[model samples]
Target: MHTLAQLRAGQLAGIQRLQLSCGLTEFPPEIFDLADTLEILDLSDNALSTLPDDLPRLTRLRVIFCSANRFTVLPAVLGACPGLTMVGFKSNQIREVPAASLPPQLRWLILTDNRVEELPAAIGACTQLQKLMLAGNRLRALPPQLASCTRLELLRIAANQLEELPDWLLGMPRLSWLAYAGNPFSAADEQAADAATSIAGIPWERLQIGQKLGEGASGVIHQAVLQQTGGQQDVAIKLFKGAVTSDGLPRCEMTAFVNSGDHPNLIPVLGEVLGHPDGVHGCVMPLIDPGFGNLAGPPSLESCTRDTYPADKRFSVDELFGIACGIVSAARHLHQRGIMHGDLYGHNILHCGRGRSLLGDFGAASLFAPDGPHAAALQRLEVRAFGLLLEELMERCDLPAATQASLTALQAQCVSADVGARPSLEEAERLINSLRA
Candidate 1:
């Protein structure tokens, strides 16, 4: 065992790993001398502003954790570490990403909760990258070169300033998972109101709140009937609770749902209103005829698991394939329009009967610019989520042999740890269509 003072000496020749967590602010310069044999370093929760210049000497280093620091810029020598693969720099004061500063072997880059407004175009050059997390930033756009990263798998770019998404996002052959909520452009009008404010527009006799649909992080959803309307339309209304104490604005999750708008596979928004004084944010959406519960709900997951083994008692393989295809098609449509469904899961997808499936709950969606750093990150995250969903479906026991084989192969390709190995929405659609035929 190494003595406490000897480990602090920074001259320990055989030291391969070092962890300094508490009671330290700055790293001594002499620490760089051990770079030759060091493979891992943990210096999180410090007040570090910069790294030593001679860090590149650690040719064998592979992982570095430097989260919760005061770094405005990355160390210049990080890119020089030839064997480096993973780097964590979350909760920092970073403003920009310099392309030339990243190492070629980098595979995982986590930069969440930073002040970064832009990314280097050279990021796409790192073809080996897999998981890239850029949540809680100020980025307004993404770079087109991102499509070149054929190996990327998981990406999370939630909470940015994006306004629209690039068209090529849907064309990425390997992407599957993503989440990009809390963007200004994607904020819906309904999400801007509160409970009292939403009901102010329509008279009480005209609206009748029905069964409780579900509850979200900040509000509750209910099935409603508009008696005053000549057509007697059935609608879904979400009532915002008293969570917005800071600025009186609706929560980010509520905004994502209202902004999604109308689609055959989506719950169409009829109107939005805000009740006064109480400040209730509510949205009116066309209700599904039979009111199919979400797949992620307890009932659905339990049913699927219980019916897995007995092929005769399980849901038909054709029905499962049809549902998957509908999901992919809806995702493609949303991506083509520059929208990212940040929170995609079985629970968010609702069956509309007759081989029709609707992608509901846009409470986590965002619109990003076509060629901005934010969009690139959002697309990558979506690819990762898609892979996970596919994996879940394949594990179901009741699926037919042929359908299971095809789906398993597709899921394997989409969920590859390498982000670039996942299939694009278009490719997934094609594969689903072929299976249907």
Candidate 2:
């Protein structure tokens, strides 16, 4: 409650918490002297451009909220504070983040809605980081060193200008939650909307709906057989519920599928169908029938934990590598055509036949635009997700020792936290081919 004119040096000594949400254009340098006991500071919704260089003197500080500020650069001195754990700098004007400026003990770093172009490789030094929010930035790539953050769990880097994702992101065993969309490569085309509607026009009466294949936040998928086609096809029909129709997600997915054309390793979009009175909308795809003696369907990495399976039965490395190669090839083709499959994971990939894989699910695809402001950020997120997927595949012990080593090394190169450190899809393809040979 201290007035701006009455604020003094010794007045803040006993204050453990401070909220300066009003009438403060700048933080008085004298405040940093309170480092002896101050634990929390809230300077949000202010006009401040930069933090005081001496502010890190507060050794006891634990959390700092500096959202909605005009900060273009992070204070170098803040990294000197050993006790700092959480830092919120969302909705700022930050343009770059040098690795040497981060606090070593930081656990949660939120920097959403800034103009950051890249992340410093030194970020991997912060092994304690668990939750990182880098959404709405201008990053083009990620540093490879990020794989060192073994404790990281939640990473949200949506809404940027990414072209490709690296392979190492899948290795983080603790990572669970991830969200990346609105990238140039993942952008939806205007023409794709009509195609989605057309694809949704498939006749349900002409096909037999079998078991449920999968479900997502948007809709459910089912395995079905078409009597006219004379063969079974894996159809993922998305019934737009209460709100998705208006959100343009269905149209986006449709556009991506229609525009992507066809590939052997990609699920062919046969057609789309809609239900009467807006009850449902969906598309038809080829069914990947499980051969005799094989499991009903491929299990997600999460579902294959040791507790879920008998000790004697385990996933094989060769199978996982085959899946990885197929996905990489599909992604390579998509990127070459100026498209980005926003979401890439084991669940989105389907094993069509022996050594054959198909990349499906265009619900999150977008067009690639390298000149846009967000291009780099989008690519980094994709790389991160790819890294995570590769890590999951390499975890299979049944994979041959030599094969596992080769795949692991390739994944490590792709998932590098530094976006620039990640290898191009073409380079990745060569690596995979070498292993195949």
Which candidate achieves the best lDDT against the true structure? 1
- For model 1, the stretches where C-alpha displacement exceeds 4 angstroms are 1-6, 9-18, 29-38, 188-250, 254-388, 392-400, 406-437
User: In every candidate, how many clashes are there?
Assistant: 54, 49
Quantify all predictions' global Cα lDDT against the true fold: 0.65, 0.64
Clashes of 1: 54
Worst 10-residue stretch by lDDT in candidate 2? 300-309
Task: Provide TM-scores for the models.
Answer: 0.54, 0.51
lDDT (tens digit, per residue) of candidate 2 on 1-437? 44444346465567877767664677876667666778888888888887776676777888887888888986666687788878888888998776656888888787877888888888999998877777678777768799899877667566556664555664464554454445554544334334344443667677677788676534677777766655654454555442221112455556667667666667777777645344566777765655412212333222421112234444455566576677777877776555667657556666543455667767556554544554544554465556667676555446667877877887887767556667777677778877866
Candidate 2, lDDT over the whole model? 0.64
Residue 413, candidate 1: alpha-carbon lDDT: 70
Error of 2 at 88 (Å): 19
Give the runs in model 2 whose Cα sits over 4 Å from its true position.
1-200, 203-210, 225-236, 245-248, 291-317, 352-354, 370-380, 398-405
| Poorest 10 consecutive residues by lDDT, candidate 1 | 298-307
Give model 2's TM-score versus the native structure: 0.51
